[model samples]
Target: MGDDLNNDEGQLPRRDLLKSAGVALLAGAAASAGAAAAQTSASAPAPAPAARSGKAVGARLQGVQHFGLTVQNMDRAFEFYTEVLGGNEVMRDGDFRGEKIHNTLLTDQEIVARERGVNPRTIGVPDLKDGGQRLDVRFVQFDNVVIELLQYRDAQQPMGSGDSWAEPRDHMSPAYPRSMHICFYIRDDVDFNTFIRDLEAESARRGMTQVKANRVITVTSEQERQAAPLDANTNRITEGKSNGWSLIYCKGPEGEQLEFVQALGPVKKTFEDAMAARRRMLAAAGG
Candidate 1:
């Protein structure tokens, strides 16, 4: 799935991974509390509630429950997210002996076979010695956002770059539309420049690959909207003003593109909206 984890489907991925002995402190505690409640309730027989006229189960989607990305190195990925990036480790699950990836869920059989080993069951063997592919996953929380970082273990093939699959080093390839990235909002209290400088310093000290200490830019549409044409036709052009301090981008472990963004200043948003905002930010930040 490249760094994208590429499971753009609405359903959350099944967490069949074996859990680590020391799961994330906070989320673990929360889960344990919930488990304790369930156990206590189990001891006493409680009557099943009658169905109501209210909305059905899992109906009313709140929005963006969580997203995940596949990583090659577990420790490095954890370090960058929890330590360097300053997010809390929610929980860790790992050392799974079996994982199920079916053609029914994902259309690409080739990706399934390569990323996840062949399903021995499909071959008529219910139990195989190899135990299919192994997986280790951890969840990280950034306030409202939750992210799952999973590593595919015991696989013969490499993940290669999912985003770059269509074109070398290309972040966006229509071939893999499921390919995605996550961004973090910089707190208003923090100085954007200082945060960026520290990130650059840390990246350099750690010798991070695919780091872009550039492309940090500011954007504002305060003045009349300006257009930059890709060709002669205005349809192909990117429109917006690159002014007011805005956002920056960088790559995290597993080649996942992460971002730090400042709240947009008052300006008329162009049709491109967030896309135009990003362009203005990058150009203003001067990468």
Candidate 2:
């Protein structure tokens, strides 16, 4: 079955690669953490959650639920995400039509994407040509939004230049300027900092180069601000206006871009907050 799906012209056996890499990456992370803790300060304080302000601007996101991507080597990618990045394999199954598929979930601080009445099929998967590769998606929940890793399997598949999976470099891709990168909000700055350090160490251990530190700026419109308070401030905006969002970008194992963000202020903390507000409005209207 795997070969049938993968061997087709232009078809890149990405899903299979993702599954293999996910398992190996997670295993490596667990082992590394244990060994590092044993050597490092065992007395280090337990990580703490960030403080939140009680201002209701709009809704809060639950964090990233799921995403899809393509990959070259499932086994290598699996090890990078699972062992090096600390993601656990939640379940393995086929897609909606019972097509064989692999699903893995990672712990993030919050959820980001919501069902904004968009058709799932439209945003769900891309229509690729025969043997064309689909987006290799990986999910990670964080404090503010879900972090998704997207890798294209077929080298011919045009991911913008410098993307994680662009040809030439198999594992690391040059960080592109102003590209769409997934951002993850963390609760405590301390924990967030530690997570970055861990990622850096993991990259070093795997002999991958860490890219220069660059921040991504986003602007939010007033309407968008009212809808998703968390992201509004982070969105790229004109100077003098509040740039609702800010993100520190990094790369995970196998060169997948990762973003760690700090909420602009009060509005973008929890996904539950957004849902609660909607419920309250609906109740007032007697819905």
Candidate 3:
């Protein structure tokens, strides 16, 4: 995150590349959306139910346990997530395959059997007991959130025969449907621009190709925030005038999208303040 990095004009700057890539990606997504819209209904669908029931059912639910990802290599993913990003290694397991796995994962035994020309019960299991499914897994934690990384012996178009594991897909784009990226919070004490420059250097040293915006962006005006092409919920979190937010998007070791955000004011505080206000209201109501 250095100002001097931008001054170097000998070659194309990383930020320029990032901006180009972002523009291309957004343009492609827009074109794809336009083509899709021509074939579909214009109106948006109704919002999904927030809970299964009105009161008691919703109250029983807790927060998310973890987010799961099927990765190509477990060790590589572990290194990128924990070593590079400073996540805590929580738990790990290996060679997850069995009849119980089939049931728990809801494997389509018949379909797998037909595709492989094998018995439904013995698809992945060589001894003909359970489908011979196998996978390696690890869990990494960032504060309260846990990310479960898995390397599954692919169910379809598997790379290896018998005991060997299959290779995962080679490429993914943020514009692709179902593609996702995770954002990490930068402490308020850290200078966002400097942190980004350092992050770029460190990641490059570790053989990652950075795709970051040229500069840290902060919304300075309410009109700019309102004009942002974002949904309402996201706007509240990232685009408000009092938020004092700056962010940059980049890529992980395997080209997976990643984001870093620094907030000078009021993002988390908004939530904390609301909770405090609720407590006061409840106290006043004698509840």
Best by lDDT: 3
Q: For each candidate in the order shown, give its overall lDDT on alpha carbons.
A: 0.46, 0.39, 0.52
- Write candidate 1's Cα lDDT for 1-287 as tens digits: 11211112321111211111112222434444565467567794432355222435532222355688767666667666765665677888754443343233234544555566876334323221243444567898765567887665544323321221111234543236676667665543445555555554465456565444333223244121112121211111123454333565556655677665544343213322644454444334321
* All-Cα superposition RMSD per candidate: 15.3, 18.8, 16.8
lDDT of 3 by residue, 156-239 (tens): 423322223434345666777888887766554544555555555555656555333333235566455334432221212346
Which residue runs of candidate 3 sit more than 4 Å off their true CA positions?
1-55, 106-133, 154-167, 209-242, 274-287
**Residue-level error in angstroms, candidate 1, position 105:** 6.5
| TM-score of every model versus the real structure | 0.50, 0.38, 0.55
Best by TM-score: 3
Can you tell me which runs of candidate 2 are displaced by over 4 Å?
Answer: 1-65, 93-179, 189-194, 210-246, 264-275, 282-287
Query: Which lDDT tens digits does candidate 2 get at residues 1-287?
Result: 01122312322222322332233334434444554465457675543333112323232222235654344444455455545533455533211111232122211111212345543223333223233344445543322223344454444544322343234234343455543444434332223333444445455556555322232233255333224322222223323333333345675444456565544344333333555564455334322
lDDT winner between 1 and 3, please give it.
3
